[model samples]
Target: MTPDATLAARVTVDLDALAANWRALDELSGGTASAVVKADAYGLGAARVAPALARAGARRFFVALPDEGAALRAVLGPGPEICILGGFAPADIAVFRDHALVPVLNSAAQARAWFAAMPGAPAGLQVDSGMNRLGMEADELAGLLPLPPSVGFVMSHLACADEPEHPLNARQLGDFRALTDGLGLPRSLAATGGILLGRAFRFDFTRPGVGIYGGAPFAESRPVVTLEVPVIQLRDVAPGEAVGYGATWTADRPARIATIAAGYADGILRAAGAGGLAAFHAGRRLPGAGRVSMDLITLDVTGCAEIGPGTMVEILGPSQGVDQLAAAAGTIGYEILTSLGSRYSRRYTGG
Candidate 1:
């Protein structure tokens, strides 16, 4: 049966818009722009997203784990380059070699392990720069001197690229340059935010992640995901009557409330119901009315005349993008996108 025929919420992905976002970022990159498809392309399903990106001219892809790289390799075949950003693990060496995955060595021990097991295998280097969360420290690099020919590139991540004027941006840039300069290896220090920070940060290649998935830091990005939830029922409440689990919202006058078939379990953050969140019907904003429960949400749809049982309410689309929804939930777009649950009947269009 078709998705709309059921009560299931739906997530529609626009591959054309996704590819367009990549092309736009690539144009600004001034170098190759690799796609980061980790976390299943930010929970949108990497199997489909990666191939669409490949067709859009993304020759390199990045994932967060060795298993993700293996899964991507199966879907992408053998042509595109897949790099694992989680660094090397002795346990993952077989997976890496079998899938031809490149590990971005993040420390001296990881570097030593990788070089010893697969001496001439393709690999990349991730220097800590200023994001101490991962990558090799400046002092650690001294021990791996004269990186092998297989070490194709050197890269670092920016902690403040989104905040362009932050002092850490310049400091990290200088640190990366000092660490990798004169080594003559290709360098990459930018992701979506750094790409927008301008050409200097776009060394060798820029890895654009959330921006390509229709998130912020790339304001011009095309809307790529549309989420619609079915309204299971609608009820009228007299003035002063409360709605939902906690009785947190009450009708000041007579009201029509819509109970949709989705909630936090479906990745709709409960905090959004605190206030200022709304679902759309025929372009009209139907503000949320009460505490978002585990499996449902109540919307104050009193004035939306066309809304009724089975009416699909838009949660994410042209009327409200991912970032806007995230703001209402007191979180970031990355969390919203990645938190998208598996219950939705997903549809893909326009590759």
Candidate 2:
């Protein structure tokens, strides 16, 4: 069935734009461009996103957990390499083997387990340059054994790559270099932000996540997803009437309001309702009203009186980009993308 034919709100993914973003990042990388399809392609649906990326020339992909890797493998089939960032547990090792998934060993114990469990299988090493969130710390690297024949690449993450001038970017790059230098293995130190930091941080591969999905700090990236929310109702409010829960918004003058079908539960962050959030219809803005409830959002559509039930208002599109909406909600683009809920009927557009 067609997505628009249904009354439910919908999210449309522009795969061609996504591929263009990947190409842009790939050009910037001057190295291998590995797509990060983790978190179900940052909640855009890996089943669809992975194949789009593969068609766009991504030979390798990264996922956060082993199960995610297995799921991606089902969609991507045998060719493209799938790497897991969440490290592996003994119990899940069999799934990795079954799917030919590579786990980025973050600790010596994980390395030992991976090598012992599947010595002939390919793997990757993640050194903790500065993030310290995952990967092996610098101090712990000295005791680590030599990379096995199956070791594919050595990688580290940049904590402040998005800040450009942040000292940690350079420090992390230097640390990554010092640790992997002369190792003759493929080395990586960048994601989307690091890719923009230039070739110095590119290493051998660049895994651009949010950028390919149309988010910052890849500001040049094209918009990839458009969220069209269906308006279910509209009403005229008296000058003194309050709107929505908490009685937070009271009209100083008569106003036209619209209630959309999706809300916070659909990933339209609650904090976004506090102020300056709006939906768009035919290039016109409909300011948000009151608080964002679990399943609905009230819009102050006084200026958009022509809009009514069944009319689709754009919540995230040309008029309201993901970053802009994220800014209004006091969050990052990644959070906004990953938090996208599954309730919306999703449509894949473009190639």
Candidate 3:
């Protein structure tokens, strides 16, 4: 039940960078910027990320579930608004009412439930422009027009905003405009990707998620997380010898290999390792060798400038970021962040 006293693989969250990211997204939105702190602030610790965003001037926060909203409401207290994007069943309304959380009604049934449960409480509306994922479909959205008196905002999510030129962006914008036009309620159509789609998509409010956490599609955002994994041991491997599980990687020539303390179970995707990822030490890149085991990874440090047992190798930082790791893993930055292992000691810096 106890962690190793020598363990040094820690996830460093740059709170200052987090706050700055919010400001950057806010500037791009040209309207109020709400922080989407769901999934425990994308697994970067919502308890820490939320207040930093609040200090950065975010007046609203969005979470995907009621439990997340309840946790956020505790950290945010009474001032800033917390909205649950995942509509609730009748059983979940009590938590919403208890925490004074807002639910973004995604369906007529949800809307009816929310109204019947708490008639005068504030809520928002989500229309399914084209994503067809969540939100009310166009035909059903019309019947609820002019909205109830307590409706605070109308919003839609963009399906292809990251592509920039994807037709769905414009189509969703037009469709969202058609559904929400003249309602006079605050309208939000952009997240990090949509924020980059220009001011037209900004509308009255914007909610950004990954960008603030230093993910792509918002290229200008600063890196917010640094993952350092410690080298547990180093050894020399001869030509024809292999490293790690399955003996997948062999040394064509004599090589120096380092066994790091973290691996797939630590959230370094096995796919990323399969793609030949690298760790950084003293600005030198060390390629991973063989399979990424549950709790260990072998890195080829033959030419690494400097490395040894107890030396911290950077898995994610300036040399290699979450996006790069995601690319290597055939995934996305969001997954990489949210998948970070709970095993690592976490440290937050510069709020």
Candidate 4:
């Protein structure tokens, strides 16, 4: 797609890094990494992301809601199982059944609702490890559970997997182990962080969500996403010239400034302009100048005279990895990845 057809913004998902990241995490999982493609593959296009993962040898996938599962199923060609991590809404049973989606029964009420009326369908149980985000409580699980015959996969979430040595890791491990030991079901208790925790967390199936797309699933993961933006307009500004909204930045010297076509509305956080980043071309460095506007960013391009309008600047790619971008934004890479907008001329690199 032509860059001009876009609305002054673009979001390219590096599928190559995604697949590589998945493979790395899979190898870490002893070759059992089922990617979590929820939230549109963290806003990178689930249809493309899920299949890209499957091509990288991932068989299972997870999504948050039945609708997300349905979209994943559509993208993956109808047969690979999608575990609905959001469980089921009171009004969503028919939708789940219609889409052949597996609802991770989080509550006894949901389990009983499905078991009593639906008779048979593939379903799973989600145990709340330390996250307590979603899943069945331990006290709630012991009262003689009602599980479907087609319990294809069982799972849990890890709240502290990023900090491998966090005490909650072992506590969650013990709790999850106490709950699912020899349950005769394919159990998964690890997200990206949990996978890095160790082989102990690697069950029959493991879901590495953020890691696959390169959001540092583990604390030490090499970054996976690299985003690039284009320089739109370049002009000379006097030392005292004000830049962007609220006149927040004043050029320290006579500066050649290049405007970048990205900002908070386009997912580049506002903090990215607060002296947090460096824009570059080829190998030359350029300091970001002025406050980030809703649709543009200014970079002091004084010494780098070669870069001009249409020159591409690295946003979050090989040159500017997500960690640096996160550091620039005062947030984590996961937030940056998931918040990426969908208006780019998305190009899938590698396989």
Question: Could you tell me the TM-score of candidate 4?
Answer: 0.92
Model 2 stretches astray by more than 4 angstroms: 1-6
Clashes of 2: 0
Better of 2 and 4 by lDDT: 2
- Give candidate 3 misplaced runs (Cα > 4 Å): 1-5
Overall local distance difference test of candidate 1: 0.93
TM-score of each: 0.98, 0.97, 0.97, 0.92
Q: Between the candidate structures 1 and 4, which one is better when assessed by TM-score?
A: 1
How far out, in Å, is residue 282 in model 4? 1.2
Worst 10 residues of 3 by lDDT: 1-10
- Which candidate wins on TM-score? 1
lDDT, candidate 3, 102-196, per-residue tens: 99999998898888899889999998998999999877777776578999888999999889999889999999999888878889999999999
Q: Residue by residue across 104-218, what tens digits does model 4's lDDT show?
A: 8888777777766566777888878767787778777766345446766678887878887789989988888888876677888888888777788888878888777666645
Clashes of each: 0, 0, 0, 7
Model 4: worst 10 consecutive residues (lDDT sum): 1-10
